[model samples]
Target chain A: MNPVARLSSTSTGQAAPSGLTGATVATNAAESFPPLGIRRGVLLGLAVFAVAAFLLSLAVGSVPIPLDEVVRVLLGVQASKDTWQTIVLVFRLPKAITALLAGAALSVAGLQMQTLFRNPLADPFALGISSGASLGVALAVLGGAAASVSVFGRAAYLGDFGLVTAASLGAAAVFALVLAIARRVQSVITLLVLGLMISYLAGAVVSVLIYFSIPEQVSAYLNWTFGSFGGVTWQQMRAFAPTLLLGLAAALFTAKPLNALLLGENYAASMGINVRAARWWVTASASLLAGAVTAFCGPIGFIGIAVPHLCRALFGSSDHRVLLPAALMLGGGLALIFDLISQMPGARAALPLNVVTSAVGAPVVLWIVLRRQSFGRV
Target chain B: MITHRFAFTRPRAIHSAPDAPPPNGDESAIRATDLITGYRNGTSRRVVHRGLNLSLSRGKLTALLGPNGAGKSTLMRTLCGLQPPLGGTVWIDGEPLHALSPERRARKLAVVLTDRVDVGYMTAYALAALGRTPYTRWDGRLTAEDEAIVQEAMRAARCEALAARAVAQLSDGERQRVMIARALAQQTPIILLDEPTAFLDLPRRIEIMHLLRDLAHQTGRALLISTHDLELALRYADALWLMGGDGTFVAGTPEQVHRRGELLRVFADEGTEVRRYLQEIHQRWTTS
Candidate 1:
């Protein structure tokens, strides 16, 4: 009986399972980039996305344009094609440019905010810059003041530029208020709460103005809140683009000092930085970029809060030397991607950019809070 | 703490012009003639100290010792330009301190201020490298030489192990070492440390004083440290600046201060138990 059992066991083991033995065999190799090598790969992906985003943006919208025709049109060469010319020149090109600049500006502003406030949660809107600018725009458009200025200034051919200039100044006034508050309030949470409170206060004012105002003006003011790249035409782009670029360039230039700011103001000063002046410039740039985008393209929020986190997670270093460029590329790409998602299902079914951003952004923010709670900020 | 208890002899007024610096640069290293330091509250005011005269120079490790509110820290802050001298000027290289560029002043003098540092996300290397900020361009990139000096500073303060770690995670003593590292990295001719060893354990405290004295001797850099540790101060200092009540003050070589009995005058009170402790320390060290 024992012999028969041994023979039966031997027979059962006759067919041995085979295992793969080559280098191609699945192994527990790291699926994520190593810390140092991450920067190179993320940066590469960012560049690819930035280019792809540009093409996708150019090929999108109600007008049907092929990618090759759009590319030709973009190059300033005559597209032998007709609809391509209209699509590229009229719709996609301006929207694409607006989306790109807006993205870059918001991300850089976010990066500055996080560094200055020393909080990972700080973003362009965290200071209430967008809300403040929105209030300014609402006042201008609804107060019957901007309408009069628009008519008289454009009638004289000088008011066209005047409106945008007024808009920027209006936004700047609120930014200054926030900066002063930020100076006195030392804690980041206090500043953040202050910003949120300011936003609510501004919203209240806007609501009162809208309730007392005519329906048409109310609709226009309401439209600005949904956010749009479509509003910034070539003329608006000309006025808006420089403001965004200058702010971005300044943030990029300030990368090193931002590293110093991690040491706190007194230490930063002892380190030979003009601490007061640096704080001023940081506040000013964050406001200027966020305000301009809000003024021209409406209040775009979630991108400013999300892109830096994404960039930091991808690159694995808070050093601005690598982080700034990565943030810039990733920011521009993310903006275009969000814009693409918003524009899905054609013109009639198009969504707001803020809606798309919030959809992506809220979850990331929740993930951040949960992760931070589960394990500290380490 | 050697109490010589000698007769006081006031210094004769040298008939040099106020504007003309003396040819002897050593005498001109630091001078506070009848300085009055204080604070303002709206229209009201209060004085912290008055009629103070102190001079320091290169090749000296000076210690300022006093009870709390003897205006020691206030005076130190005023002298270092963190607070404006209410009734006098802080002159460096015979010019008003306020007139100098921040960078120029930083190069001439470095300070390790009382710590309330809140620099999160900064590495020890980053913190030490900040000492070279005045010498750096607006972009603030450190040169190879700057990097070397920062590394040397880490070694000098025995913080080489903590170089890559975040400043927040460091212990109090380690933080003190980091701050000293920063000042050392500054490479200035005049360095001031505010209670540099306050957070340190006994051995580390002695190590810091030894490092300061050796650094002063080798580099001929003037070092001024304020502390309440009478024993350590007496043992290591080149001179003692004693701040007495009602703005009474005297600064001299350790021998001179002992002879003048200023330590006994400021400390060793007849009533309080705290004074008894001071008396005991004073007696023990002075006798030794």
Candidate 2:
């Protein structure tokens, strides 16, 4: 190789004739025209909507108090009627807050599962967590364990606390089994199939417990399974709120890794993410969330699976920094609306919470699946 | 014809000139000694290529060319420490490759695999920014420096325009470039790619090959690519690692491989006439 020839080539080679350069990428320029501020704007809009839904959930219940009285009671001001004050302060307010927390918890859990599995169809209950909670509730209510305690009693009564604790323990057990399976298998579909199998197994156990129990215990379990946000008292909420907060914190912390996992495990590993540790964190966080919610609110469905898709539809971005908060706000808002509907606007009879959730959530999920659109995987 | 032929010869030396630096210290070259590359079957390890000694130089594009199932991907995986070698040791710079922690290994070597990742709603910018994973905090937030590096990487890969576009919506060529941009963002001394242009059209293939070649010389990074595009590999790569079916490997300059007749011997069974013609043209171009 001639040194002079090489020196000359070095100068001329620096510029290739008529080659594609960074400036020629006009295809992306068309789509990139939308300002990124739209994402922040969308998040702000959802936050405002969430607050409105919270107020609406409080004001439009069975008593149908005006928005003004709801605000007055919330601010500790004397409202027009003491009955209205008592209803808003004692009954509906706690229920609305429960709905908000439960909604956020389940929805974020669903988002994690969908990202981890790289499957759009995945949700919090896909691993049979709800079934696990149901099994625990069946054992508590049908086994005559919870019947001994009065609702207002002290330590003597098992009551809702026993049911909540049992449900949580049951969810944790199922999650543990899934975690073990996840560790052993590398395939996403295999883990999902195993989860479905676990769900069936738990459902079979719950069926057996139902068949052996008395008619009264069966009805009690049935009512609990109807999934109402109203059953959570201020006392129960103290335990429920912290558990949810822990889970939400874990979820938020893993948002970056969740973004990496979107590209699949191999890609995630190349990016220096400890793929196994990330998976464990996601599993533990998701279990803590879905398990705690099911424990407190009887496995309220729809908002968990549907709210993430709703956020994606609105923001059109999958970056979890944006998606996490968006899902939280949207999930809470959706839950508030569903809980409001469950209150039965003009009628005395309240609808089951799951009924309204399924009515709204099922259609969105169906639309996503029917379109066969890619949710990060083919 | 004389001037036209001479024009092609000059670019080769200019591209090859960056190879003079010694690959040591933090700018470590990958060296494998008597390596056995393959997968595990039940309790025992299945050997694909045994007793392999290969060194990928710093600041050069080394193309690993072999037929289907010739153990190209397996060899690369073993070399990169993605999979443990069945028998031998791999050294990165001067340290044992497998001895390094995963985080440390990631900092030293970055990879671009052929696996099509579904990034959902993440933009090209966010995807490329993930290359800073080794340097970012536990929460994976990018610092100002990390952000600047990511932007520069996107620019070098000719994907700065794609920073705002969703990865899912990009064309195959664009996506491949973005994947390379991510590897660039990793800021590793050594970069490995498996079938980087498998799905790309001819023009995009040329662009990627040219981009990778330029990246190796300009950035002074060791780049090892496993590709079936023999023509581009011959033209762009400074060195060639030819894996033969008889469990033997040959490494040399493209001209030297042609001169030694190793290129014809290994590639003889398929495309014999084309390979012969390429050798004839290569012989004339060099000797003239």
Candidate 3:
């Protein structure tokens, strides 16, 4: 039998001490954690929830296709109407897929960041990856107007692809800078503060570009900042899906190092982990995930920061082996649900993705803080 | 005195190994030669201690006692390979410490640090299981043998009752035992601990000291601990490494060093009252 199961069995076999109150014994038993089987069952339930959320996302958009038709179109059967087929296959499917991928990628990245820094508040963007991407988008949209550069004219010809390339390059630039600094610095806190400074620098540069640009260019930058999942198209998925999958794979590979890190870096090194190499891998994977999502999906927020915390609470453990997969599914499911809410089912007008996410995410974050204060648990 | 009571309770049979020689002989588990320890920042260097030689032997508990700023931490860090020694070399089990790969070094040496392990929500069992990292696969999945060793280590540390409890929820004493359990689970021939008794109460300190001494005896592993608990160290430790903070170093059995008045001399700067109190305590214990 597995160690957890064996432990639980032994604990169950022992009678409570006579002096202990019933309430204290109950609390002790609860704190022992649910058995391994139940935790696995929770993961299974999360998988089902993710699938159901994806289906709902497909069926409940502004066009409102029926669930049966959505399933039929998914299974390669003919839909009753051609428009429904086009909507399901061409539009809704890609958007839903983007939401799923973006959510999972950001969440796994966030989980890594939280563990690496040992800060509960840390997210993928804590390293200023999204800010770096924003600077790229801002330069593409507003700097082009200010400088009137012909190089940007050609970039404009590539449309959204040009914007994505710019954002990716910008994020990569920051990632490189951070990695360079990480090599020299001994502490993660130094890296975190440097990241914030880099973010401010980028934000300041973008602000200058915005000040010089016309209203149309300014709005264009603003729309990107609002964030959206629907912006990614089928052709873009060729680049988007594979990048995210690679990032997620890298995250899964880091389970061992991350577990060691929970005891802190010194302890991790004592355990034979090459601390420097492990930190590099974690930063690289987290940067890649956050950067890629921001490039394709315009820096979606809340899902990255919130999902990992939610997973930790629900799963009742900090073991990366459990948290990584849990975050992947729960993050994707939450993102899909938020995306559905953004679509506003019966209304033609859609809310900005960030607006819906922040609206819901802020409260969840508040609840977590309150709960932690009351329970003295992280 | 409390020391005499605990001394009487100690299992003296474990010290009856016929072939075992006194410490500082050929049975040294870790040997440092002409060692210099310090920190370097860019172009500037600050040397803490210089040209020192030390050896820790198997089947013994050695207390590394020193006043604050006496280079105790720097020496410990250098010995564990956490920091590079400015000069000289350290050897573990006859192999140069710097030459060994991290994996090999981990297998040969384990450490329990003073750093607070705020591993939120991790069970003691799970935390102890991490000691199997060097032996386990890349994913750190513990094998059946690894699990059994972990359970045994916890049992040996007298923390088997805390196996299912979250480490975060453990009392300081319980947590210290769990951390010791982790080091024991590593199965290294040598273990180093920095201030293992700090932040613990009087009874807890004695309990931990007794446990460490017992562990060293039972497992025949060399154990070195840097601590501020002078009384406990004198009572429980087999040997003592005294860093006098004035470029003087002394090593010998606790009784030998005390007889030479080296312990009193090392802590002389603590103030006259502390020195006089230590002398009184020493007089009472020795006479009793």
Candidate 4:
């Protein structure tokens, strides 16, 4: 059935109230959604932008490779120089892929958090899951287990596997605590506040661990805190990629429940949704996504909170089915751009990932907030 | 003028059992037997009203009239399964409400709550479309049939013009209509509203009440609205369920309940001023 046509036909001859006649109709007409074609066009544009950004990230680094050569190299044809192949394959490829995965993972996680909590400011880290991961990493690097071996010596021995394991455990601990608290708390705000408190407690423990540790262990932990997309190598991708994909799939599954939740829990319950079950799945999916990214990439900031809002503005719809994909693409695309800027193209020194993220992200978010007069509707 | 535009027409039965007998049949849409409604905190329990029997008949507009804190909301909540009754059984379409699954319960009954809906950036159509949640697939996409129902509901509620507008931008009256449309879209046999007219002005309240009465008469659905608008309830409701704060309960047609002095007894604590006001309105209404 043509709903729009039917709607117009039904409303045309009806004597609508005077107050709703002119200005209301004009304003409502202006606010009417663009057709599905325009939304699809936006999604297509985002996908292209993401692909372009990925190629640009591969092309622009300390040793710049030509775009065609980078494309040829990616396509498995031989490049002009051996070093170019080594540069693209060994260094930039994993890093770009890491940026893509981490960006999409965090952004999707953030979107879930915002919806689940009904808070516009909520992000993947709003629950302090990242703090829990940091605690796990801190314990591994500075606690007695690693104190017995010198920092550099232990790095060679334990590898990234040990750190990833530690981070995952920490995030899991927070996830479990949040879930337990979530079951008992009737209000999402209560859960949000409790998550914040848990985050602070984890951070406090990490600080004390840092204070007691040897200088080398402390320095190692500090470097990890700088956050990087370069840390995940080809070997680690085996675990990182699948875990994030699992989390993303779970997030996509929640699009429907999340949409229902937009009306609040009571209404959702009235509509036959198992509100408790929906909350559990949403919390689990968001925690998994946020936790996995924090495990590999350290606590990358802003992408989770920023990208969802960006997508909402760009697409002009709050529907999760649209926002999730938009967030995934725009998040990856924006992350690559940020990573490229952090690299400074030819500059020898690379800025910390978090620094570049917050610097670029904070202003854009502020602009959106100031212009819209509120964060994108929760 | 707008009232005339809302002239009611009989629509197809959107209920699951379309071929069922007409609503004038004496079957109860919802029945509460020996129901105890109250609040329980841990080991402690506070009973609001106990041993009450109430039933809402199909094709009827039943107004639950009560003064402040007379357990009207508690009773409404219990009937809708938002809260478990402290004792006894509340049945919907002859099935125990508590025993039914959430999906089954939703199919049989829909509720328009007084709780504020703060759905950000959702268009009126999308908000109304959420009524299809119980029926939609995992992804919640609406089928063509579902779309037609939603369109029909919006048309019935007279808010089809507001379909493309964001819910956040709508006035209270407009929002209430959209909410009613959502309940209509649910295609349930029974709809319960908790103070659906609370935030509206007198004209809007009268309009809403008229729309609801017409909906019940035309669609053969049972509607029970808990409201404080006694004058309107007396004028429009098929029956009145009076809940006295002192735990007394009475149910009958407005005139029957008034003749029995249930209205005076329910509002006795409101002092002589309120008693005089009630009697004066009742006298004017009946004499006219």
Candidate 5:
């Protein structure tokens, strides 16, 4: 620790490859690795937002219960059949939870994508994942005219497991196709363009379906495109939570290999990773996260494309060990805050969630582009 | 006899010492022989080299050299399990290398390929800690033992001073050491480097080679490196594995390598002097 000791220590390196030690077991280098102050700060901020949003989601609505009453009900200290408690626990909680889960899923998917492509602007929706979900949703909503594939021997038609499953299948299909294209194409820019083309192709299909459908079906389909957190029922949540968690977990497990992959496939393979399997898992997890959220919550936007960049800006590094957790908390908190605003308080005119998301997410994105200097290339 | 001692400025004795230790009593180190590897793109599934035999003498430095595409990189990659063999086998100790689990293989062999692929924020120390991943749990939290090894590896790699810098922000030479530090933390018996000095500037490249030499000599570990710098490889390496462009690989002492005309064949186009002077100048050119 002293200057003299430090001087003596440096001089030893010139003499030999003798490691700086006395052979006694020393402190682990990894533990000694300093933690990022910015990341720790961002994490604290996210925790605050999560708690505030959860309370606001319970307290803000047409009923407008006191914050204390909402807290009490959540803690089970008081009982009520009042609309406030009902709305707080069942309607708003489900919607709030949906927003949180959906946001985290999309953000993590986007983070994985940007890293994989080595492109700054890559995101889940930007890479055709949202469109894949849209096609699946359109097929389900407009299928009233035809024989739909029944999930459990009966067609629920408007919103069924068949539809959600179809969305996942569509997303998986698109992801698989994109990955193959990514492999064949040498340039990252070309990959981004190919993804956009896929999105347009899927978007065209959805528009054509909307054009031919009955007015009622067309209306339902239109609402889905605008995006919402209100459609997830308890039944939907039961299935949604597990798949999303599994997909998130899969993405998390790949953190080490994904870090190695940034160098190239050959480099990753040399480190003893199963390159083909890693790519497959990457596709599977991204599609699952994007697909399920799209099917149940509608085709949300802005969150996936922007949250990851924001996370990087906040954390100031690309390490997934930190990025994944930051994305989870930040995405979930932001989504909850957006959902709370979606239900217009005094005015009867509630805004679609996408409009609110764009207002909030866009400025930050613009700021990122404007000051791309602040956040250097990863 | 294998003379694998650290702190050697230059050996007074010619070749190995008259008295050298036996290969060793440990039955779990790497021993390679007659490895053949190559690529299979499109129509051609060309063999890199056939009947190219070499032993990765335990506790010694082994340098593999040849021209750009003479398959030195391919051979190193194959040894690391990234590429597959066209013929012959590579064994770890007395057992088949591939027969071991990937985790087990990681425990025995650590590799530093010539590419930078990290996409996340990591300090030099943290990157070095990843070397302990095979020994750690699935969560990859470093245990007491993992921690001890990582620190020692960092010291050996001489990356302690840069421990706090983000890997993304480090210069090319420093980043290379960070990676080598990570591999050292793995504490594998066999370490393979593929043109580790390629991107490094002169002094940094020599420093890396010196570090590798130290690790092998001190730990009784096997070190194999692929490089285009023939003179440096010839001078420092205990054994030379040379691959010629005409699909021939021969391994022996530096004199044996030259005697086979393998060095001349790979370093020159059909006709040119295989000047020891040219070798020195070419090496100086890289450093300069």
Candidate 6:
């Protein structure tokens, strides 16, 4: 007889080998809690931090309005000077709100990209979005009559609208191309590599444009690249806010499929998730969030790459349900804090938003990578 | 006593009528008819097998055995609806496989593959809860009943204690059990697995085979496993599907296939001694 039959015949009543007994099976079923209480605590803390950061950003700008006055004006109590009111309500409030939206939007996009690609290093900007937006602005300022149009009437108004429009369209075009390529590629690493190549291609195009453009236009492009949240007006927010909200909403709906995708495509499909449809939804939502933010905020970096890592580290869970809200709060809070620091409080010259963001964001990403001891997630 | 007499009278009359189809056909959970398995490269098709007919009956454990390059994975993939057949039809529990939506198909058939799941942060319970994906709402929130089902699947797969543990931290055997629990939580009538024992040690391999066999018999669910462990397959599996070197398939009881010498046809090319060894084993089994 065979060894299997010989063993089974020797041990008639027992189901499995002695090594795997009922007692051992019972012992093997050890349970561990997922730190949900801690996650809730982190969420609450982030929410508070985000609110405080927003208030600080509004109160500590060039005029340095008192916190009480900032609150009073915000509550419409009429305690501050009219000039202070104008700075607080007109200039700083919208800018702070823009910072909040851009931070949340980019962070959520980054989370989706990281999860979908199963790569920890993937960011919203990885798909050439920032470069695409830069090329758009470059073409408008250099190739078009944007400079001469600024020389005409209503210069600030027309110029901002034209640049925002150009940036949006340019980001959207590159996003469409990435999605088109993504459909054919099954491997996440391949998709990420394609995104990197596209970024390089867009960067090359932007460099050629920069070389030939006038010095003033070149400066304009360079200044935009440094990034800021100061220029988004109420009119712009109407466009920016809704798109970000819609993208976030779409992302939340994909929370289930995104979790399934963590196991890879074959497993996700077996779980009844239409892999292709989920991929499309993820790509569309990620593109909309990142693309719209770049159009308005000049492609703010770091938060998109860093906030998701921060959320994962805090919550100790990969479930999108928790990570989504956590990222939103943390991203908004971080962006507001950086914006406040960049304003230089008492000084007239403000630091570039990207400089403040990268200084903060790069360290967090580096620390996470080292702590995890891996550069890319499997 | 009158009720007992009545039960016997009516049931006996009904049971006497031969209304049921042949046992195999009546219990078939999945059937493939004249399946042409192959891969498509650009405009050309490389066919693996043609005129293939196979039936996996409910409450049966079938072991799909084949050598390397025998297109076992391709056939398994095609049967699970992961890839479209080159030219054939697959029916699941009386419904056309293609006619069912992915959600509907999931409700009918669950698949367990050898691919490693790299989700580090999810607990085993949450991963198993994903099996309720088809039944859950669009947002994928688990209702109380869904949670109970997930818990029951974990218990059945003997991973209940590991429910709270991170999937990434689990050992290979533990992870495989959790994956099986996830498939069980899917609650489908038919489960297809590709090399479920590929990475396991000898004891774990035997244990997994026993577990799968018990699950199939107890749940009345059909299990079709593709594996390289022919010894365990012959011992535990109720039926065998052997893929030949020339891309043909034969299905029968292990004893029947061995008696018919079809096993030799597939294993002969491995070596003359291997074939002789198999013949010797067959002689001992038959004599015993």
**iRMSD in angstroms, per model:** 24.6, 11.1, 12.2, 8.9, 8.7, 11.7
Q: What DockQ values do the models have? A: 0.07, 0.25, 0.24, 0.32, 0.21, 0.28
TM-score of chain B of each: 0.85, 0.87, 0.90, 0.91, 0.81, 0.89
Report clash pairs, candidate 4: none
* lDDT (tens digit, per residue) of candidate 6 on A1-378: 222233234334543323112222232224442332235777889999999999998888666788999999889888548888888889989999999988988899999998888888889877777778877777776655434553221332256877788788789888888788777776667777777887888778778777776787778777878888887899989988999999988988988888788888888888889888898788888888889988888978889999999888787788887888888888988888888888786767889999999999999988987776662443
lDDT against true structure, model 1: 0.71
Fnat of all models, as shown: 0.17, 0.31, 0.33, 0.40, 0.27, 0.50
Checking candidate 6 for backbone clashes, the offending pairs are A29-B161, A29-B162, A30-B161
Q: Residue-wise lDDT of candidate 5 within A1-378, one digit each (tens)? A: 422133235435675543233332333334344642235766788878877887887788887888888888889766354776677778877887888889899888888777766666677665687788777767776754544453421333434565567666667677777767755554555657877898899889877877777887777667767788887788888988898999898888767666656556665554555556666566567767887788777778788878888887777666676777788788888888888777768868889988988898888778877776564652
Q: Write the per-residue lDDT of candidate 5 for residues B1-288, one digit (tens) a residue.
A: 111221212111212223222234444245556666877667778877777655677667888887777778888877777666776777765556677666666766788887654655567777777676565554445565556556556656777678888777788898888888788766666789888888777888788787777767655678888987766787678788877777776778776765565566566654444556556555554465
Q: After superposition, how far is residue A299 of candidate 3 from its true place, in Å?
A: 1.5
Query: What TM-scores do the predictions have?
Result: 0.78, 0.84, 0.90, 0.89, 0.80, 0.87
The number of the candidate with the highest DockQ is: 4
iRMSD of prediction 1: 24.6
Pick the winner on lDDT between candidates 1 and 6: 6
Model 4, B101-203: lDDT tens per residue?
A: 8897888888999987887667888888888888988987777667656656776677877888878889899999999999988878788999999989999
Report backbone clashes per prediction: 4, 0, 0, 0, 6, 3
Off by over 4 Å in 6: A1-41, A144-158, A178-194, A374-378, B1-25, B273-284
Model 6 Cα shift for residue A330 (angstroms): 1.5
Give model 5's DockQ, 2 decimals: 0.21
* Candidate order, DockQ descending: 4, 6, 2, 3, 5, 1
Tell me the tens digit of each residue's lDDT in model 2 across A177-257: 878876666666677787788789878977887887668778878877889787789988888899899999999988878
lDDT tens digits by residue: candidate 4, A1-378: 233233344444564422112222222232232232126878899999999999999999778899999999999999999999999999999999999989998999999999888777799988889999998888888874446653433552367767777788889999898888777777788888888898889889988987887798788787777789998889999988998899888888888889888888888888998888888888888898899899998999998988998888786677887888889899989989989888896687989999999998898778776866654342
Order of the predicted models by TM-score, top scorer first? 3, 4, 6, 2, 5, 1
lDDT of 6 by residue, B132-217 (tens): 88887877777666675566567567677788887778878888888998888787878899999998899999988998887776
